[model samples]
Structure formats: C-alpha cells, structure tokens
Target: KSVGLNQVILRYASDKHERIYGMGEQYSSLEHKGKRIPIITAEQGIGRGKQPVTFAFNRVFMGSGGNWHTTYTAIPHYVTSAARSVFLTNYSYAEFDFTDDETISILSTTPTNTLCGQIIGARSIPETVAAYTEYSGRMEPLPEWAYANGVILGMTGGSAKVRKVASMLRDAGVPLAGLWLQDWGGIRNTSIGIERVWWNWELDESNYPDWHALREEAAMNGTRLLTYTNPFLMDARGPKGRLYREAKEAGYMVQTVAGGVYRLGHEPGVSFGLLDLTNPAAVRWIEDVLHDMLKNTGAVGWMADFGEYLPFDCVLHSGEAPIAVHNRYPEDWAALNRRAMIRAGLGSKNEGGNGEGMFYSRSASSQTPRHTPLMWLGDQLVSWDAHDGMKSAVLGMLQGGLSGLALSHSDIGGYTATPGRHRTRELLMRWMELSALSDVVFRTHQGNRPLHNAQPWDTPELLDHLRDFARLHRALAPYRAELMRESSLTGMPLTRPLFMHYPHDVVASRVATQFLVGRDILAAPVMDRKTSRVHVYLPPGDTWLDVWTTQQAPAQPTGPRHGHGVWLTVDAPMGWPAVFIR
Candidate 1:
C-alpha cells in the first residue's frame, strides 16, 4: 500500500447468461455487461447540437463527435441477472470491468480501506434496490406541487419579468407548479462570454428589487420557487465578502498540500475557492448561509449544482485526503442543504413541521437518494439522435430509476442550443411530448445563452401542446403521488424498465425506447422528429388497453384478438405520446 493510497481489486465468477445493470447514469444501453465504466463526475460537452455552440468554462467545445458516457452522477452498484448484487461502499474513483464472461472485476483506489458489500437472494432488480437502500437510506416524499410541470426562466431578467411570465402562464391556462430561477444571485464575465460565477449566497437586489414581492406573487399563483446554489465561494479579497473571510479564519476552506486555498479556474482569468465541508465549523457556515436565503427570500428550495470538482491533492479539516472525499462530496453537499433546510423549519412532507422543503441536484453518489428526493438529468443538446439527444434522456431516466433515483427529469428541449440559432417549434414539441409521459417533473430551461431560450409559447402550435401536457401532468398527480409513496417505502423507482415486470419476455429486456410508469401504464414516446407512428411490443400474459384509443388488445391465453408479444405500429400523431394501460 502506498502512503495516502490503497488499491483493491475484487473479482467474482459470472455465468455467460447473466445480464447486469447499474453504474449510475449511462446513456448507451441499460444493460452494462461487456463494458468498462469509469466512476467519475465531470461535464463532457452536450454531444452535438444542430449548430456549433461552445462553453469553455464547462470544457464544452465546438465539435460534432461527442462523448455520451461522461456523466455528472455515478453509483458504484450493480445487480446481475444471476440473482446477485454488489456495491462498492467506499467513495473513490474506480474502474469496473464487466467484459469477461467468467469474471467481474472492480479496481478502486482510495485513501481509506476498501469496503464492498454484497447482497444475497436478490431475485430481481427491485429487491436489490430495496436491500441497497436499507443499507444506505430511502428518499423522502416531495411536495405535491413539484409533481406538475415547470419552466426554467434564466435569472438575467429582473423580478418584474418573472411576474410577467407567471401572468403569461396563468392567462394561457397552463397548469404550472414551479418556476426555476437559475443564478438569481448574480453573474460574472469569463473568457467564455458571461456565466454564473458570483459566489455571494445573497440574492442580487439590483436585478430583483422586488424579490419579496415576486415570491409572494408566485405563492399566490400556486407555484413553488427553486433557485440555484453551488458549493464554491469567489475570491474572499473582494469588499463586503464576509463569507470568505469567516470561512478562511475558521479554517473551513479546502487547502492545497502547500497550505494555500484550493481554487479552481473556470476560465483564463477567473478562479473560485472550494468549501471544505469535512469541517464541522465549515458545515455550520454553509448551513447558516442557506438558512438565511430561505428565511429572507421566501424560496422553498434550490438547484444544488457543481459537486464534482474536489482536487485529489487537497487537504481537509478532518485530515482526510481528497481521494476519500472526492466522490462523497456530493453526499456532503446534499447533507449540507438538507440540514440547513430542516434547521430553517423546512422539511420534506411537513412531518408535523411548519413547511415542506426539497432540492433537485445534478451530481450525486450512492447515498444521495436518501438525502435529496428529486434529481434532474444534467445538460443535454437539442438533437434527436438516440446517442445524446432527447431519446438518450429516456434511457437515462430508465437507468436512474433502477439505480434508485426515484424522481428524475431532464432539461426539456435540451439546455445547450447553438447561439444565433433558434430552437425549432417541432423540436420543443417533440421533447415536450416525451417529458409529458415520463415519471420525472417536466421542466424547460433556456440553454447557456440567455437569448436562446426554450420558451414553450414560441408558436401557437407549440403553446397548445405545452398546455395540454401540463393539464395531463396535473390530472395524473394522484397516481404519481401513489407511485412516489411506494418508491419511498420500498426504495424502488417510480418508473421501471419493462423487463422489471415481464421478466420472462425476451423482447422487453431489449426494448430501451419505452418504459413503464408505476406498474400499469406504459409510455412509448416518439424518438425521431416528424415520425407519426411508433412500434410497441406488448408483453405477454395480460390484456392491455390503449389509453389514446380505448381498444383492447389481448396478450396470450386470453383471446385470439392479438398474439402474445404482439408488435403494434400505432399512429403517434404530433403532440401525443403513445401510451397504454395493462
């Protein structure tokens, strides 16, 4: 063993017929056999948009060839078709080798002793997840309003603009539940134009002069508020920066091995200091900041962002090296927000408390689901390709559910569009149709550039579809809530892969384009643009009814109306997602 590092390789014999799943959020295929997965969280560019768009601060460059496997979240846990499961309990980067037919090996390097846990008698995926959650923790129930669709309005517009948008949604008769305000605090200019680099946890009164009034207006409209927050603090040398100075004096900021603050350079000329959450004083410092935001702003929650960049050579107040702290950083970030929310009298589901609180995050580890309830798929491009486009998001949702992210969503219509190019009406509608059927909250965001926004009311046709989906989401709230409760109690995801239920159906195991919401409803969203019909494989042993058309199709041993494992090419008209009930 090396001085600050211990490497362990665990191997097990496997059968040739075994199917494996998990390794957190993978876009390429749900089954993870014969693949090498690196457990690291970093932003690999948003694959390929129609035009060239670059965000250097995030390491996104102008390129057509994209890396779809680069992810913001990872869980080093898996369940095999052989009725066995494995979980790497340590928080460190590791390489998983599942390519060998006879042997599965996991090589991990960490500062702490390697500890892995295995589950026996895991006959199915759901059972494995339940056992894992018992060792970790289960999620809490989200507020009722979060089950509906939401729209992301970038923070550039002043408080008045938010009110105007809220009014627009109400006038348009759209059932809106949440409004996402990203970087409401402020922004700074970096080499890649302007980005949200300001670290002051307080809202920018200059842009939001009537911030309190805006919150009251949103509450009146029955909408919950979610703002953005990261775990970084800008240079403490700036005037009126009490947060930085206090953290520095209290020895709460992460330091390099040379005894300097561990800083990150987002661009050529901008840098920010990282918070050392391992320190008890530092945890209290960050919690106080969040508590003040909740008490003053009337905000219910935040979009916890950027927990993936802890330096491996840094030192912590707990004296643990970065290898032991890197992957666990996201869990710490989640804990910091959750504790602060609870301390401020905002908890999940009110549990005899005063208020309900929630936070949707992009980066998380194996235990994050136990702390935060909702998860949003990280940034995506506005493309239709199955690799990194809207369809890939469907695959992500399915994988995330099996891995225990019960409530998950993606940026509707994508979040990175080419500058000077507009997102087409058809593209947004297609994405909306898919988002409408998924188990996650349907939310839209203006990409990196403020001008290139995915506003649903762009066209009359688009607005009509958006309003319809919002209504549908609200109508299904009761059913969604039931599924959420089940998820919380059993640690199973609200959404499930088709094979999870029809395990014997060979075709269901290979179908990744469609998914089952809860237990009975099946959602098969049209993946390609301009496609009017989709092929669906109805699993055997049940009579399924089409939700769009109340026609009954029998699946084996019931009637000769439809054959077992019948593949139907159903018409999926524009603005409609192909759905069925079992």
Candidate 2:
C-alpha cells in the first residue's frame, strides 16, 4: 500500500462553511481555506522581483515552501472558524491541502512518523490562541527600554562617529532607547566594499579602540549599547580568527556528509564556516564567547542573527537526521541564546523583573516564541510594495500574531541594498507613522550599503513628525502594556486581523490592510506613496471613533446582522496614519 519511500499523507473532512487561519507568515488572504500551503522556510530575498528563476530554485533547494511569499519562518498551525484548531507537531517537509472544501490532506516528507496532532475545540480564536500558548510557551512582555526608538549605523562609521551620531539623535530631540553597533563585529571586504563579517564574533579592536570606555559613556547618556551575532565563522586564516580553528579542532562545526568541516562562501566574507549548535559543546562555547563580549563591552543584549542555515546533507552532534531537525533549527538557536543570556546573568527576569535582558531575532518557527522575546521583519527593500514593504509588514504582523509571536517589529526605513540612493524622506516618515500606531517595537536600520545610512538628522523636515510619532508610541504605552499582559496571560497577538474580531463580517474577513491593536484600537497604516486618504471598514455591532479627529463613524448601513461593516475614507497624509477606536 506504500506509494512513496519517506512520505506520510493525511486526509480529513471540513465543513463547507469553515475558514482556516494561521500558517506562520504568508502574504495570502486572511482566510486560508482552499489553498495549498507548503510548510518550509528559506532565504527568500527582500521583495518581488523579475528573477523567478532564483526564487524557484531556492524553493526547490529548500525542499518545500511557498516560493514568493513565505520567508524565514513557518509554523504548522491553523485555527478554523468552526471553533476548532489543529497544530501539526512535525518539523520536516510537509504540505497542507485545503482545496477539497470538504477535506484537509497533509503529506509529511519523513516516514515511520507518529501521526500526532493537537486538536482543540475552543469557543473563539482568542481562546484557541490561549490553548496554543499553554501548549507552547507564553511570550513575556517587553520592558520599557525596548519601547523607545532605536538606530543601527552602517559599517564605515567608527566608535567616535557612532558616539557623534548618538549625540546627533539626542540633539535632534529624538527619544532613543539605544544605539545598535552592527559593525562592531570584525570587518572584512566583499564585492560591495568593506563590510562586517559574521564569523568573527569578537570586537574589531582597530575600529573601536576604546570600546569598553565608549560603551560606558554611551550608557551614561541613556543610550544602551547592542551588537549583532550570527552562527557563521569566517575562514581560519585571519590572525584574530580563533573561533574557526578551535571549533574545527573540537569537532564543534557542522561536517559535510563526506567528512571534514562544512564550509560555504558568502558575501562580506568570501567564504565562512558554520557553528553546529546541535552540539552541546558548541553551544557552551558560544555561550562563553557571548558572556565574554557582554562583560567586555557592557552591552545589555545582542541581535541573534541567521539561524535558518541548517543543511539537508550535513551532520549533527545530536545524532538526529538533518531532515528531522531542519525546520526546528531556529527555535533551537533561540534556546541556545536564551540559555547563554541566563548563564551570563542577563536573562529575562534573571536579576529583577524589570525585563532587563532580551535579544532581537528574524528567524523563527512554532517553538520560537517560547525561547525568544522579539522578532523583527527581516531585511526589506526600500520600496512600497506588497512583497516587502509596509503592506507586507502589516500582513506579516497580523500573521505573526496568529502564529503566536505577539512581540514583533520591522526595520523602520527598510534594509535592502539600493544603488546610489537611500530611502526617500517620504518613505521614512510614512514608515515611522506605521510603526507609531502598530504594536511592534520601533527600530531603524541603515540599509545594507556601506555608507548609505538613513538617519532622521539628514532630513530636517521629518524631525517634527519623527519626534511626534515617537511620543505617540510612548502615549500608547499603558494600552500596549495591557495588550502585553493579555498576551503573557493568554496567547492573543497584539495586532491581529479584523476577521479575528468580526469573523462573520464579510468585509472584515477580506481586509488585510486593517488590524485591531489589542481589541479596541484599529490601525490602517498607509502603504502607498503620496497617499492622502485611506478607506477603512468599521465592523458592525459597535460605533467606531476616529481617534485623530474625535468623530464617530456610524455602524454598518445594511447586510446580515453581524456580517456587515461601514466603509469610511479617512484623511491620511504622508506622515499621518489611519487609526480608530471602538
């Protein structure tokens, strides 16, 4: 009866009226029924492009997953409008078929697998999330330190320039939480120019001569210090690159199936090695390295980068096959960092409950929220499009909320490389407006280019809007804390789709641009450039108030009792966002 060697297929029936939601982060409709969902993760670069060949090859290379919309994270979970939810526990290649309106079929790529799934019968979606969180772990609330605006400088800048930039932000009246020194890691050269390499985990002593003293000074200015960390190690020839040599000698690196250490070539560093965190000893080694870095630089936390690098043809120290552990790699990497932080006495609620310790990540899976506190929308292009711009971010957050990552954010001005030009002032301001009203933490990054950093100081026209929106974000603190508390106690996302609230409302079910922030406030950030007005749909059964103008919009004009909504075209200039409360 077996048709395939390592494939397991699942089939089930679904009511015609039931609608499905949840599949990690996808750019599809809010209602996921009648769709074929591939549960795989890959490095799907920035936005939609003409390079279909590249995307298609990566999709095949990655085994399974959506080619265009799916990115670094994938959670095999879904909730139905019938008050039923299903959580697939498998982490390997799998496909979900909801096309049969009457049936749901799933095919797992690995055989001899136990067909295990958690089905919950809840009264509502929120309740379903609560059950899911109880099964996985609940996400903790972010501390006040994380609420402020942040900036990441480019690689050309040294310690003094960084200090100057921090001062510039303060002088410009920008409320800054911290200055993220991304280039603090060792420097290198790629096709682009001098860049920071991922492999060398140590500070570049030449660039940051007084690293310890400068970090202490920056801390005094209320600007906390943060750095970046990834799993790649550059070649072993660099005089200061001891991590590579040591990891290989101790058998702490991932080995190719043929034997010997596995190496790969990439940008910034012509070639590099990978750290196999599946090896307990390797995890310990990384923890020690991070502890040393924290002690030396007085940094409060780090940016845990690049966990989506597990190869299908590689070896692991845990003795588990690569196919079995590939999809769960990000969650494991998060746990490794979490343990490292705890060992360094900088864990979340380690010393006191002030929420002092945290790390920002871009890669995740279903178990990621249990170990990580925050996840940012990965490197996005500097354009306004559905693929990787404001629209994608909005949908991504809503999807992430459904996936159980309540604490999320995006690069404020975008992070993709654009030749000869930085993000326009209009784009930056519009993005700032979006970040202001959303539940995601606010942060900025200089796109990947060497010297092309997007700084608010460069555009004097945006200073007022930037400062005002930051104040707006701070003003929403109390309400945001309430949302975080609910997320911590239960598993509801901070920002979820309108359909989650008005499931029966026909309009709300299809509106992905609008979302509810903690049940009362609705944020519809302008995703178009130079747009002055945005249409909003007010769900039936409640009178909605425009928070900006203090005016109420009447309920639905007509339709099935609870399935109706009123549409309102509201004014939304470049710097203003469309937000309402009910």
Candidate 3:
C-alpha cells in the first residue's frame, strides 16, 4: 500500500521458526530471525547497535558510529531456513521488518507505485542458491594472481613509507603480492574516519614523487601496486580539486534543485562531490581517467571502495528518482570499474581465463556479483566485539555465500580503529590464523589511524607470526584455486555454511561460528580475545581429519547423516585456529 506520494509498504507471510539470512555483509548475526534490517547503503557505523562505542560515538561524534541495522552493502534480499529465497529491485532506502513473527513487511520510499522482485523456489539449498544466482548474476572467476598471492597488505602514507614497510616485511620473510595504498593521491586527516582521504584520482606527484619507479621495482620483485577509488570525489577547495573542477565545469556532477553543483553540503564545500553516473559524458570521462591512471602508474588492482551514499534528495542527469536508484548505486560503481579494468588492459582473456587485474569491493547489491571481482567484509572494528569485528567477518562471508556473493573475504587484522577499539597483539595473531584458513585473498588494513594500532612490524614476534600464516596461505593456494574454479562454474560460494553440504545433519543448521571452505574443508576460527580453543561439531558421514594434527575422526563418526553430530573439543593454540579436512 502507498503511504504517500513517495512512500509504500509491502507485507508478506512469515515463518515463525525459519531463521533468515543474507542482506549483504551484515555484522549483527547470520540469522536475522527476529530483527529489523534496513537496505540502505552507507558507512557501517563505528560500533553497531547500542554497544559501548556506539552509544558514546552517537552522542559525541553526531551519531556517526552506525547502529546495528546500518551496513555498506545493503541488499533487499534474503533466504530462509525453509529454502525460501527472495530479491527486491528497489535501489533506494528500504527496510525489512522481521520483528513481527507472524508477518514481515517491506517499507520503502519510491516515486512509482510498483516495485519488482523475485521469490525463488527449488528442491534443495544448493539448487535454490544456483537458481538465485542464475537469476541475479554469476560471479566471474577470480584472477590467477588472487590464488598465488599469499597476502595483499594495505601499506599507506607515501612511496618512502611503503618502501620501508616492504623492506621490513621482505627481510622478515613475509609473503606479499600487492600493496593497497588508499592514500595514493594524498592523505587528509579529518575529525572522523571517513574524511581521512584525499579525493583526487590521478597521481599526486607531490605525494608519490617516484610512483612509477616504485611500481617497476615491485614488479621486479614479483609484487604489484594497488590503489583505492570510489564514486564520490572530495573537493579540497584548492588546486587539489582539479578533478572536481573538471567534473563540475563539464556538468558531470550530481546537481541540486536550482541546478548547481552540490558539494555534499550547503555549497560551502565541506564534504565531497558526487559523480553523476547517469551522465554518459561523465562515465566516459571517469573511464578515461581510470585507464590513464592505472596504465601510467602501473597499478594492477584497486579497492573499489564506497557506493552506498546516494542520497534520495539529489537531482541526476538521467532525471530518474534518486531514491529509486539508491540501492543499485554500488552495483553501478562495480560495473563501471569492471569496464575500466577492460579498458586498461587488465581484464581476463576468456570467460574463465586468469589475469592479474583485480578489484575488491565491500559494498554490493542487485547485480554486483557479475561485476565485483572480489568481496571484502566491510569496515570491522579492531576489537573482538561480535556485532562488528573478526566474528562478523565470518558471518559476512557465510551470509554472502548463501546470497550468491560466492567469493567473499575480509581484512586479516580489521580496519576501523577508535581510541579504545584498536587492534592488539593477540588479535593480529588469531586474525591471521582465521585469514590463512579461509585461503582467499589474505590481506590486512592499517586501520583508520595507522599509528595507534598494533602493527605486524611492531615486534619480531608479530613479524614471525605473520611470516608463518602467510606461508600457510601460500601453501594452500592450489586448493583455494580449485575452490575458486568450482565457484565460477556453479555459482556456489567458496565460503559455505555446514548445512549447505550436510543438509541431513541437524547440527549443521545451528553451527554459526564455523564455516566450510567449499565441501572438503572446515574451519572454526577462534573469534574471542585471549581464547585458543573452539568446540567443533563434526558432521556425520564424513571422514574428518584435523588439518593441524592430521588426527582421524572418532569411531562411529560415520554414523547416519540425519542427527546432531559429535561435538569435539580440539586444541586451538594462538597460531592455530581449528581446521579439518576430509
């Protein structure tokens, strides 16, 4: 029913006992049985919900630290325990109200009367996922370098700093494939986290004077230079605003009601300028800019950063309703980058062919998988909090698996860093273990404030811990490659829930802390601080061997596949998170 000229509500019957999952990298939990989830894309606030950090940040920092319902990749899609899958077409602001056990409602603001969606039905969970992805979009096979690269580390500041870190890590025998420098253009430290970046996309000869030289040197050592990008461009209000000026003069930026350039505020230029993707000339201009920058700078990949901040009150060149086109903005951003990849000669040759070009996205919705080469669990707090930390990364990957984002991963040590919520020595150790076991693109972030966090180069012990886990990741590259290959063909996620493989086992449905890396391997990463052991549930009908110890499963483990399997307590030390292989 229509609430007003631009508001509507749609309700559906709900299953009281069926647990809900999948809404693009949500951190609260994997099962959203009785929670309200919003499908609006924006920064995943500092500490979600009414947590300690959130409560303080909201009052002090103007509520910038988002609540539990806030997320980066907010997709209006979900799958239930009963195998019911659904996807909504709205791109703008929307909310899924599951608080009511008997009835679920979808409330959205739209200029039109109708909304589009699909209710998928299949015989089994696997088939249901396959059909859902086939209808939405299948992910492209990851580039060969993704499997071979032991880890992709984020080293920021400038060329000099990057070289120093590289020399330290290489001397310590740590493996690295790509160095993602988010401040490639320059660094701009603001009062909060989001504005700690310079917006210009081109090479800032001042910030990176010898950028190409560093790229060449890295290439000689079998490494690649990567950078970051997003749809919005910040105006420094000075010569650093060259790109913004060009975009504005060409009438390529999103405008206001009076047809003036909107500088993310009331025209005083305190924020960034939103690039108008609806304009063909603007898209072409950005494409050329991306191609020239990468081709000239020798950057192989980039973190295609944000796409979730399209405000509904803006005027676009296409004249489409801004609210209606909000949710799909991130998908558009990914597709734009994919096209840029091809233009820059970094794209793969054939359908399943391998190439060095890769871009990892944290925000996604609608048809993003077809364009997003990789998915990284978005901004997680540096602490061990379940609402938004190491544990949330696991839930994000598993949720993406069921929702068709088949190749999701996360930052090894986490990104978001506040005063009290920064990274610690033990957190880094356990995080590396979890990352190595996943065997995807193992990577790390320097947090929002690099100097405050505990880094790998902090001590020799941390370096040795990094060296060991990176080697483990590299050693398992071949197996990870096989999983990626299977994902490309069948649309099954590399990070699967236990129930996807052991449907008959009742315990598999309830195991949320652990995840399956494809069908052959299982991992139960210790997500707690100062914790070493994890109680694992070995599903029935499989010969499970502890990956660390090579110990066989208990007797009668091959019992019927229908009941709750045996709960085994295994020793998981600092360097070893529980992992089992079939």
Clashing pairs in 1: none
Give Cα-based local distance difference scores for all models.
0.74, 0.74, 0.79
User: Any idea how many clashes model 1 has?
Assistant: 0
The alpha-carbon RMSD values of the candidates against the true structure, listed in the order shown, are: 3.5, 3.1, 2.8
lDDT per residue for candidate 3 within 8-86, as digits (tens), equals: 7889898787667787777776668788888887778878863778888788766577877777777788877677877
Worst 10 residues of 3 by lDDT: 555-564
Alpha-carbon shift of residue 465 in model 1 (angstroms): 2.0
Best-to-worst ranking by TM-score: 3, 2, 1
Off by over 4 Å in 3: 1-15, 100-103, 108-110, 191-195, 265-269, 351-354, 504-506, 555-562
For 4-50, candidate 2 gives per-residue lDDT tens digits of: 46877888779988888878777544677778878776564644442
Q: What is the lDDT of residue 557 in candidate 3?
A: 48
